[model samples]
Target: MKKMISWNVNGLRACMKKGFQEYFEAADADIFCLQETKLQEGQIDLELPGYHQYWNYAEKKGYSGTALFTKEEPISVRHGIGIEEHDTEGRVITAEFPEYFVVTVYTPNSQDELKRLAYRMEWEDAFLSYLKGLEQEKPVIFCGDLNVAATEMDIKNAKANEKNAGFTKEEREKFAVIKEKGFVDSFRMLYPDTVTYSWWSYRFQARQRNAGWRLDYFMVSESLKDAVADAKIHTEILGSDHCPVELDLEV
Candidate 1:
């Protein structure tokens, strides 16, 4: 089986200080992906001998960014969804291997009072189309902090958060559309009713109480569903507010 792990490191440099290297080495994933790196090019040097590193940095300094480390070199790599309007945030990185494409994305937050919901909706449409385009060639294993919970079951306090950015009806509907478009939520597919989460807020002792939202995900093309051996959340390991999620594939 091939193993892959994805995490929203929150900040790679800060995470490194908090035992990121130890966890990275121990996890030993075939492919590892990260979101919210919050750095510019050359900001920090990471030495992972056996892996090829690919990064996309937001034009704005100290903001959204993503990186991918893989044991197998990809045939090709691309950044963004090919939409100039949505590409500025350095939110996406796609690595194409012989069998499939690995995409890591740090999806945009709708922001306080849903101020950015309009743009986020646009992003959802374009991103979905981009994945479908890639699927024309091969299956896709896309992972990262998706920034929204697809259903009430995905969040701890669904009723209370009904109007919140990540759990709002608009965001949830968009997430549902992705599944409708030939993708399977790998973790949900394995543990359909598991009450686990990937992200928590620092404000209200959320992680301590395990009151969090399932924001990070690994979604694969529907055709690859049976090849999915296992899916998991590494809630025990911690460096950021969010934890690592893993997927094992028969491929």
Candidate 2:
């Protein structure tokens, strides 16, 4: 069995100060993925004894970024999708393994008043296409802060958040399309009625009240569904607004 973990650290440097390494050592995941690292290259030197690290830094510093650490090195690693337009933010990293590809994406959020919704929609289509392209060669396992509370059950206050960025109808539909296209949400597939969330806002003591959204996820190609041994939300562990999600695969 391989243990895969994904978390949005919010800021790598800040998270490090908050016991990130301690959690990392305790978890001991085979492949650990991170989003919203919020740092440029050379900003920090992270040493993980046995894991190889790969990072994609945003052109604009301290904005968006992703990193992947794995015990076994990948055959190849790609920074982003081919499109130059969507690649600048450094939100994606794809690592090719012998049996599957692991992708970590920090999807762009449709800020404040849904000002960036149009661009986000464009990104959704392009990103999904990129994943499908990779699927042609082998099964794909992708995870990170997707930034959408996909279903009504995914958000604590779905009715109040209908027009909000993460809970917007448009964003929900896009996530549904991903499911229709053969990607399985490992957590939801395993625990259909369970109520859990991966992200929470800093305002109003949201995390304390458990008013959160299930924005982070581990999605595997339909063919790998049976290989999913467990899916978990590490709500008890805290270093950022978003907690870590785990996927155990019996590969």
Candidate 3:
């Protein structure tokens, strides 16, 4: 059995103040994927007893970044998926195990003014292509904060957010391309009618109201569907604006 967990911690430093260590110890996942680390080089010093840590830091301090903690070491590891421009934010880290490659990405968010929408579109296309390229070699288990709500069911206030950054039509269409390229959203597969969520805004006391979006995800190549055990949202765990997503599988 293999277990993987993904979370957008918002800020690594702040999460540490809100029971992060406790959550990490209890998860005991085979591989843990983290996004929005928001740290610079030499900023964080983790001490996980049994996991090998791989971190990709942004060139800018206290900005977008990602990390992975894997109990099993990969045969090879690559950063940024071979794209120079996309690598700037430190968004992706790929670890190739004997059986599969785990790629974690912290997708670029279109800001409030939606100034980055065009760039975000480019990223979606490039990222999908990158994963497809990797699929030629091995089954892929990709996880992270994708930033967009792929479906209307993915957010509490879907209609209200239809024109918003994360639920925009263009963004949603790009995500559809991913599904067409043969990836399965593990969580939705297990519980189709379930309306579980992974992220909430600090404003309007959204978390307390259970008003959130399913921004984080665990996806795998369609060929690996039979290996999926369960996909869950750990909404009970509080710390970041986002909660954690867990995947159980026979890898």
Best by lDDT: 2
lDDT, residue 230, candidate 1? 97
Q: Considering summed lDDT, which 10 consecutive residues are worst modelled in model 2? A: 146-155
Cα deviation in Å at residue 65, candidate 1? 0.2
TM-score of each: 0.99, 0.99, 0.98
Note the Cα lDDT for every prediction shown. Answer: 0.95, 0.97, 0.92
What does the lDDT read for residue 136 in candidate 2? 100
**Per-residue accuracy of model 1 over 1-251 as CA lDDT, tens digit each:** 89999999998999999999999999999999999999999999999999999999999999999999999999999999888999999999999999999999998999999999999999999899999999999999999999998887889999999888999899999999999998999999999888899999987899999999999999999999999999999999889999999999997
Per-residue lDDT, model 3, residue 163, is 78
lDDT of 3: 0.92
Per-residue lDDT, model 3, residue 17, is 94
Query: How far off is residue 97 in model 2, in Å?
Result: 0.5
Instruction: Give the better candidate number (1 or 2) by lDDT.
Output: 2
- On residues 82-177, what C-alpha lDDT tens digit does candidate 3 reach at each position? 888889889999999988899999999988878999999999999999999999999999999999898988999988898788999988998889
Model 3 TM-score? Answer: 0.98
| Model 2 misplaced regions, further than 4 Å | none
Give the runs in model 3 whose Cα sits over 4 Å from its true position: none
Give the 10-residue window scoring lowest on summed lDDT in candidate 3.
Answer: 39-48
